[model samples]
Target: VGDALKDRFDGASRVMSNSDHETSVQRNDAAPHRIPRKDRYRFQLRPHNPDHKSPGVKDLVYLEPSPGFCEKNPRLGIPGTHGRTCNDTSIGVDGCDLMCCGRGYRTENMLVVERCN
Candidate 1:
Protein backbone atom coordinates (compact mmCIF):
# COMPACT_ATOMS: atom_id res chain seq x y z
CA VAL A 1 0.00 0.00 0.00
CA GLY A 2 2.87 2.39 0.90
CA ASP A 3 4.74 1.63 -2.35
CA ALA A 4 1.50 2.01 -4.35
CA LEU A 5 0.85 5.41 -2.75
CA LYS A 6 4.45 6.49 -3.44
CA ASP A 7 4.19 5.50 -7.14
CA ARG A 8 0.84 7.28 -7.47
CA PHE A 9 2.20 10.51 -5.92
CA ASP A 10 5.35 10.34 -8.08
CA GLY A 11 3.35 10.00 -11.29
CA ALA A 12 0.55 12.46 -10.32
CA SER A 13 2.33 15.57 -11.64
CA ARG A 14 2.99 14.02 -15.09
CA VAL A 15 -0.52 12.51 -15.42
CA MET A 16 -2.74 15.23 -13.81
CA SER A 17 -4.42 17.64 -16.29
CA ASN A 18 -5.85 21.17 -15.85
CA SER A 19 -9.37 19.76 -16.33
CA ASP A 20 -8.73 17.17 -13.59
CA HIS A 21 -7.60 19.94 -11.19
CA GLU A 22 -10.68 22.05 -12.02
CA THR A 23 -13.00 19.10 -11.43
CA SER A 24 -11.29 18.27 -8.13
CA VAL A 25 -11.56 21.93 -7.01
CA GLN A 26 -15.22 22.02 -7.93
CA ARG A 27 -15.87 18.80 -6.01
CA ASN A 28 -13.97 20.17 -2.99
CA ASP A 29 -15.92 23.49 -3.04
CA ALA A 30 -19.32 21.69 -3.35
CA ALA A 31 -18.81 19.49 -0.26
CA PRO A 32 -15.65 18.40 1.54
CA HIS A 33 -15.71 14.66 0.84
CA ARG A 34 -15.07 12.40 3.81
CA ILE A 35 -13.75 8.80 3.57
CA PRO A 36 -16.38 6.11 4.39
CA ARG A 37 -15.90 4.39 7.80
CA LYS A 38 -15.64 0.95 6.15
CA ASP A 39 -12.95 2.08 3.71
CA ARG A 40 -10.94 3.67 6.57
CA TYR A 41 -11.18 0.46 8.60
CA ARG A 42 -10.11 -1.61 5.54
CA PHE A 43 -7.09 0.66 4.97
CA GLN A 44 -6.04 0.24 8.62
CA LEU A 45 -6.36 -3.56 8.39
CA ARG A 46 -4.22 -3.79 5.15
CA PRO A 47 -0.92 -5.67 5.67
CA HIS A 48 2.33 -3.85 4.76
CA ASN A 49 4.74 -6.12 2.83
CA PRO A 50 7.88 -4.05 2.08
CA ASP A 51 9.79 -4.70 -1.18
CA HIS A 52 13.26 -5.18 0.36
CA LYS A 53 14.74 -6.89 -2.73
CA SER A 54 13.51 -4.40 -5.37
CA PRO A 55 16.33 -2.38 -7.00
CA GLY A 56 14.18 0.78 -7.18
CA VAL A 57 13.29 0.58 -3.48
CA LYS A 58 16.93 -0.17 -2.51
CA ASP A 59 18.28 2.81 -4.56
CA LEU A 60 15.70 5.19 -3.02
CA VAL A 61 16.64 4.38 0.60
CA TYR A 62 20.38 3.50 0.65
CA LEU A 63 23.26 5.99 0.25
CA GLU A 64 25.34 4.42 -2.52
CA PRO A 65 28.50 5.93 -4.18
CA SER A 66 28.97 8.52 -1.43
CA PRO A 67 31.95 10.92 -1.33
CA GLY A 68 35.03 10.25 0.83
CA PHE A 69 34.68 12.44 3.96
CA CYS A 70 37.93 11.86 5.87
CA GLU A 71 40.69 12.53 3.33
CA LYS A 72 41.65 16.11 2.27
CA ASN A 73 40.31 16.09 -1.29
CA PRO A 74 40.64 19.68 -2.61
CA ARG A 75 38.64 18.95 -5.79
CA LEU A 76 35.71 17.66 -3.65
CA GLY A 77 36.03 20.69 -1.27
CA ILE A 78 36.62 18.41 1.71
CA PRO A 79 39.26 20.29 3.76
CA GLY A 80 39.83 17.53 6.28
CA THR A 81 40.59 18.32 9.94
CA HIS A 82 44.30 17.42 9.93
CA GLY A 83 45.42 20.19 12.34
CA ARG A 84 42.07 21.21 13.86
CA THR A 85 42.15 22.15 17.58
CA CYS A 86 39.91 20.05 19.81
CA ASN A 87 39.20 20.01 23.57
CA ASP A 88 41.29 17.32 25.27
CA THR A 89 39.15 17.02 28.42
CA SER A 90 35.64 16.61 26.99
CA ILE A 91 34.50 13.13 25.90
CA GLY A 92 32.41 14.50 23.03
CA VAL A 93 32.62 15.02 19.23
CA ASP A 94 34.84 18.08 19.76
CA GLY A 95 37.32 16.05 21.84
CA CYS A 96 40.85 15.49 20.44
CA ASP A 97 40.51 11.69 20.52
CA LEU A 98 37.47 11.56 18.21
CA MET A 99 38.40 14.60 16.06
CA CYS A 100 41.83 13.14 15.34
CA CYS A 101 40.22 9.83 14.26
CA GLY A 102 42.40 7.85 16.73
CA ARG A 103 45.54 9.34 15.05
CA GLY A 104 46.40 11.30 18.33
CA TYR A 105 47.18 15.03 18.72
CA ARG A 106 49.96 17.36 19.84
CA THR A 107 49.76 20.32 22.31
CA GLU A 108 51.68 23.63 22.13
CA ASN A 109 51.65 26.86 24.16
CA MET A 110 51.80 30.37 22.66
CA LEU A 111 51.86 33.95 24.06
CA VAL A 112 49.32 36.54 22.91
CA VAL A 113 49.18 40.34 23.42
CA GLU A 114 45.77 42.08 23.60
CA ARG A 115 44.88 45.82 23.74
CA CYS A 116 41.51 47.39 24.74
CA ASN A 117 40.24 50.93 24.77
Candidate 2:
Protein backbone atom coordinates (compact mmCIF):
# COMPACT_ATOMS: atom_id res chain seq x y z
CA VAL A 1 0.00 0.00 0.00
CA GLY A 2 2.76 2.45 1.01
CA ASP A 3 4.77 1.75 -2.16
CA ALA A 4 1.74 2.26 -4.41
CA LEU A 5 0.83 5.51 -2.65
CA LYS A 6 4.42 6.75 -2.94
CA ASP A 7 4.47 6.00 -6.69
CA ARG A 8 1.21 7.85 -7.26
CA PHE A 9 2.43 10.82 -5.22
CA ASP A 10 5.65 10.99 -7.25
CA GLY A 11 3.71 10.88 -10.52
CA ALA A 12 1.40 13.68 -9.33
CA SER A 13 4.38 15.82 -8.28
CA ARG A 14 6.13 15.28 -11.63
CA VAL A 15 2.98 16.26 -13.55
CA MET A 16 2.51 19.36 -11.37
CA SER A 17 6.17 20.41 -11.68
CA ASN A 18 6.19 20.07 -15.45
CA SER A 19 2.99 22.10 -15.77
CA ASP A 20 4.21 24.86 -13.41
CA HIS A 21 3.95 28.29 -15.15
CA GLU A 22 7.11 29.87 -13.72
CA THR A 23 9.60 27.05 -14.47
CA SER A 24 12.73 28.00 -16.45
CA VAL A 25 13.02 24.59 -18.10
CA GLN A 26 12.41 24.85 -21.90
CA ARG A 27 9.95 22.21 -23.12
CA ASN A 28 11.87 20.04 -25.59
CA ASP A 29 9.91 18.98 -28.70
CA ALA A 30 12.55 16.30 -29.46
CA ALA A 31 12.18 12.47 -29.47
CA PRO A 32 10.13 10.81 -26.72
CA HIS A 33 11.98 9.42 -23.68
CA ARG A 34 10.79 7.37 -20.73
CA ILE A 35 11.38 9.50 -17.55
CA PRO A 36 12.51 7.32 -14.63
CA ARG A 37 10.14 7.44 -11.60
CA LYS A 38 11.58 8.51 -8.24
CA ASP A 39 9.90 8.96 -4.86
CA ARG A 40 10.37 12.37 -3.22
CA TYR A 41 8.92 14.54 -0.45
CA ARG A 42 7.82 18.16 -0.57
CA PHE A 43 8.12 20.68 2.26
CA GLN A 44 6.77 24.20 2.53
CA LEU A 45 9.16 27.14 2.27
CA ARG A 46 8.76 29.66 5.12
CA PRO A 47 10.14 33.21 5.28
CA HIS A 48 12.77 34.06 7.91
CA ASN A 49 10.30 36.31 9.71
CA PRO A 50 6.67 35.40 9.16
CA ASP A 51 4.53 38.17 7.67
CA HIS A 52 2.07 37.96 10.57
CA LYS A 53 3.57 37.71 14.05
CA SER A 54 1.19 37.50 17.01
CA PRO A 55 1.27 40.39 19.46
CA GLY A 56 3.03 39.78 22.75
CA VAL A 57 1.13 39.89 26.03
CA LYS A 58 2.19 40.86 29.55
CA ASP A 59 4.21 38.00 31.07
CA LEU A 60 3.21 36.70 34.50
CA VAL A 61 6.75 35.45 35.10
CA TYR A 62 7.43 38.53 37.24
CA LEU A 63 4.12 38.72 39.09
CA GLU A 64 4.60 38.41 42.86
CA PRO A 65 2.25 37.17 45.64
CA SER A 66 1.01 34.67 43.06
CA PRO A 67 -2.78 34.56 42.97
CA GLY A 68 -4.39 32.12 45.47
CA PHE A 69 -2.42 31.23 48.65
CA CYS A 70 -4.23 32.37 51.83
CA GLU A 71 -6.61 34.99 53.24
CA LYS A 72 -5.37 36.50 56.58
CA ASN A 73 -2.09 37.68 55.04
CA PRO A 74 -4.21 39.00 52.12
CA ARG A 75 -3.28 42.63 51.78
CA LEU A 76 0.29 42.74 50.46
CA GLY A 77 2.56 45.72 51.16
CA ILE A 78 6.15 46.80 50.65
CA PRO A 79 8.57 45.82 53.39
CA GLY A 80 10.13 48.69 55.33
CA THR A 81 9.77 50.97 58.35
CA HIS A 82 11.17 54.45 57.68
CA GLY A 83 12.94 55.95 54.64
CA ARG A 84 16.09 54.62 56.24
CA THR A 85 17.55 52.27 53.58
CA CYS A 86 16.63 49.68 50.97
CA ASN A 87 15.56 46.59 52.90
CA ASP A 88 16.90 43.19 51.79
CA THR A 89 13.44 41.61 51.81
CA SER A 90 12.67 39.01 49.14
CA ILE A 91 8.99 38.09 48.94
CA GLY A 92 7.75 34.68 47.79
CA VAL A 93 4.36 32.93 47.63
CA ASP A 94 3.75 29.38 48.76
CA GLY A 95 1.60 26.86 46.90
CA CYS A 96 -2.07 26.29 47.98
CA ASP A 97 -2.28 29.48 50.13
CA LEU A 98 -2.05 33.22 49.26
CA MET A 99 0.29 33.82 52.20
CA CYS A 100 2.89 35.68 50.15
CA CYS A 101 5.54 37.70 51.99
CA GLY A 102 8.98 37.80 53.41
CA ARG A 103 10.81 39.31 56.45
CA GLY A 104 7.51 40.91 57.74
CA TYR A 105 4.40 41.15 55.46
CA ARG A 106 2.04 39.71 52.88
CA THR A 107 -0.45 41.14 50.38
CA GLU A 108 -3.75 40.10 48.86
CA ASN A 109 -2.52 41.28 45.47
CA MET A 110 0.77 40.94 43.70
CA LEU A 111 3.20 43.86 44.10
CA VAL A 112 5.50 45.37 41.54
CA VAL A 113 7.98 48.05 42.65
CA GLU A 114 9.86 50.27 40.27
CA ARG A 115 12.07 53.31 40.90
CA CYS A 116 11.98 56.41 38.72
CA ASN A 117 14.85 58.81 38.66
TM-score of each: 0.38, 0.15
Superposed model 1: Cα runs more than 4 Å off: 1-61, 109-117
Question: Residue-wise lDDT of candidate 2 within 11-44, one digit each (tens)?
Answer: 3311011223224334567964434343122222
Worst 10 residues of 2 by lDDT: 54-63
Report the poorest 10 consecutive residues by lDDT, candidate 1: 13-22
In terms of TM-score, how similar is model 2 to the real structure?
A: 0.15
Go through the candidates in order and give each one's C-alpha lDDT.
0.55, 0.33
